[model samples]
Target: MARDYDSQLLESVAVRRRRMRDALLFGAQRARRSTDERLGKVFAGIAIAAVLCAGCVGWSFLQATLAQQKQQQQQQYGTPSAQPSSASSASTSR
Candidate 1:
């Protein structure tokens, strides 16, 4: 008789615990506070504009550096077109 009462008590406790878990799992599953969707779009637009501005600045710097190097090389070796006759003679000899 004591063993039967103990078994019944354990089964009832187990059933109550299961019901509490099920209720918590499937209840009040929505967000408590919501945010503006436009905030995300504004951030995205700013990110894209920053990337474009960086690209433009980088391209201009590259062009200026290349131009400076070309000018230095021209000063060191002189212009190739400065002596047309030598170029023609070299080509003809080859």
Candidate 2:
């Protein structure tokens, strides 16, 4: 029995062409489905979470500082609000 060399060669060449076409169609968009890609995504999510947490903490600290300053200002100028100054009363009488 004689093997058909031409048919085998044509089959192999067709397989190669099919693979090349498939690669061209699908391989360019997602070349490597790597574990590192997943790991990098997780690390990026963690980094974003850390940044958001830091921002919240900084915002709370800023609000606390502003409240403290407001309290200090209120203490400094509160006496005039509680009771009218005598000099203003005297000037009003005149």
Candidate 3:
């Protein structure tokens, strides 16, 4: 009878150990999944920021080019000689 009891006790301990190991493995897998999800979100945010920065740089360059074109146009067509007689006389008075 004592031997049977010892055997039953050993079996129960083994079962408990197996359950503990499974729980530990499941917890580790869950942690890994969570970490992967967070990393994906972080990389996505970084990509968006990079794209926005590029867009802003492009817009600034476009604005500068437009301004330069406007200045060139003014110099070409809107010179002092192109002014009306009244406006030029007013400027000389000033």
Best by lDDT: 3
Backbone clash numbers for all candidates listed: 0, 0, 0
TM-score quality measure for candidate 3: 0.54
Candidate 3 residue-wise lDDT, 1-94, digit = tens: 9999999999999999987886776665776766888999999999999999999999999999999999998897867556667797889999
Provide the TM-score for each candidate, comma-separated.
0.46, 0.53, 0.54
Per-residue lDDT tens digits for candidate 2, residues 9-63, read: 8899999998898687667554464455778899999999999999999999999
- Which sections of candidate 3 miss by over 4 Å? 1-28, 79-94
Residue pairs in steric clash, candidate 1? none
Q: How high a TM-score does candidate 2 get? A: 0.53
Q: Which whole-number lDDT from 0 to 100 does residue 16 have in model 3?
A: 100
* Candidate 1 C-alpha lDDT tens digits along 20-89: 7756754453232123335677889999999999999999999999999999998867866667778899
lDDT over C-alpha atoms for residue 49 of model 3: 100
- Backbone clashes, candidate 1: 0
